[model samples]
Target: MTIQIIVLATNEKADAVIKQGSLAQMPSLQDGWRFDFRKQLKALKHATAYILVREDSPEVIEGCLIFQLVDKMVPYMAFVEVAPHNKGDEKKHDHVAGCLIAYAFKQSLIRGSGRL
Candidate 1:
């Protein structure tokens, strides 16, 4: 399923998307990502990952979220990170983390017992 949601582009002051992504599309440490997502994904069986990318440039990931349903009952966010360019003073986008976090909540609601 292609779950596409909007984010804010700080530079252009427009919207972007946080879509469902694959393990194959995971970023590497060399890519300036702080975490080793591949290793995390491999270790966590319950993990469900998503990536944030531009609506126009889906090839470039702006952020990511790793959500886990703990014991099939509790909603847990294992990890969440914005891209190197999406952080600090030189950031290109805004609300990257917010979008991912909201998506996590949405997932929790969808997968949970319909109660937050």
Candidate 2:
């Protein structure tokens, strides 16, 4: 299935991300880094959330990422994860992580940060 990326800007969308089937399935603590998505997501002032949806099914989220616009010029991606089914060699989709990074780059440019 094709993937569509969108910036989450509403409570409805936020709720969807929280209720997604893979939400609880994802690691509560990031490996090697120890960041908490649940806690981090709550602090919206520090980061923006972006999600990837399966084109054929809006309810099916392929991935999600947390990024911050720092100094009003730098956009930093703090956390990212693909749906469990989309990880590893038998992954359901390709470049899910790359898509999020690209979106982050787009945000940086939009904020007048120029080329990264």
Candidate 3:
């Protein structure tokens, strides 16, 4: 399965991600999960969001990440999750979160943060 990682851009796209995230199940997020894309949209001064999706089927999101540029221009991972079908032992995909983190590192480089 070919997956493509992208930066979340619009509220319309964020809505789609919010829908998928609501259906996603991650152990790390089980305690009290909440991905406030609305808040992200409202406050993107130094933040960005990322998502991974099936290349051929854009609607099928595999993972997501939200991060911000903090002091010293560091990329601070704020929120992250993988789709329900792509979590745990019966996962449909692998290393999606890793890919997101790698992407964040790349962004940090692009933004002149040196390294992530």
Candidate 4:
């Protein structure tokens, strides 16, 4: 029941897109989930399953996506986007963020499903 969480690099301000708290809070991401930042270059070496992306936008810190891979394949995932203080633009960004995550997951499944 081990889960690997991977964060992707974004084009925006690196510090803003990659939150230190999120990286630190990896241990709290659901039960049996492990967090590995890019700094830990060797973490991927032992990964049997992968959640290719977990991220939040700069506009809101509450959006997150958790993609799960079971038996070396993505079975399902959860995407959440929250608008802090009901900000309209932030809400839109949250939706886009969720959609982006879902699209990536779908693409990964399409690419990996046949191989497995």
Candidate 5:
């Protein structure tokens, strides 16, 4: 499912999308990402992954999210990372982390129905 999100472009708020990510589209450290996302995905076997990309440039990922339900109850956010361009003061986008976090919370409400 596509979720609406916002990104920064020339200091303006632009539309983006958050959706389920597949192994084929996974990013790696070599791709200018801080973490080796492929390795993280391998290590977090039970987690579900998601990616944030610009609406006009789906090919350029802005961030990634890895999450899962802990013991089938509590929602646990295992990992989250934004592209190098989305980090620090020179960041190209805004709300990259917030959008991923909000997505996790939404998942918790939808899929994590059990109590911890």
Candidate 6:
């Protein structure tokens, strides 16, 4: 299975941060914090999942979520948001994000579920 992730930026600032390809890279939120998108794929490549990003602002992370489709048919999803000023929040955000993505996919399979 092949999954595609498209990064969306409102302006040049966010645009500049993104690199091209199946493994597009971007800088982390904190100064000097960087990670390669390739590494993320290496971790998830075995799974039947893909990511599509819509970057509005760092604030969007507060409302970001993930969705997944299995065998191009069954859909599952979940909802998630970030908690401000918490050390463990990042992990929580990731978990919720994954769930939200699955939720969105599942909802898409239903009739008249509307946009996620």
Best by lDDT: 5
lDDT of each residue in 24-100, candidate 6, tens digit only: 33223351223322333345422222232334432222223223333444443322232232115232122333333
Reference-based TM-score of each model: 0.83, 0.61, 0.58, 0.34, 0.86, 0.28
RMSDs, each prediction? Answer: 3.2, 9.2, 9.5, 10.9, 2.0, 10.8
Task: Assess candidate 1 and give its lDDT.
Answer: 0.77
The candidate with the higher TM-score, 2 or 3, is 2
Give residue 22's lDDT in candidate 5 (0 to 100): 91
Measured with C-alpha atoms, the lDDT of residue 71 in candidate 2 is 62
Please write out the lDDT profile of model 3 over residues 30-93, one tens digit for every residue: 4323554545534655666666665556666577776677764876766676767766566655
Give the alpha-carbon lDDT of every model: 0.77, 0.57, 0.55, 0.34, 0.81, 0.31
Q: Give the worst 10-residue stretch by lDDT in candidate 3.
A: 11-20
| Per-residue lDDT of candidate 4, residues 1-116 (tens digit) | 11222222232322223222233333322322232322232243322222222234333343333443445554444333332322353222223344435544664665445344
Could you tell me the lDDT of residue 11 within candidate 5?
A: 59
Q: Candidate 2 on 51-106: residue-level lDDT in tens? A: 67654465665667777776665778778777666665665565667776777676
Q: How many backbone clashes does candidate 3 have?
A: 0
Candidate 2 has an lDDT of: 0.57
Q: Pick the candidate with the highest TM-score.
A: 5
Ten contiguous residues minimizing lDDT sum, candidate 1: 1-10
Please list the residue runs of candidate 5 whose C-alpha ends up more than 4 Å from where it truly belongs after superposition: 1-9
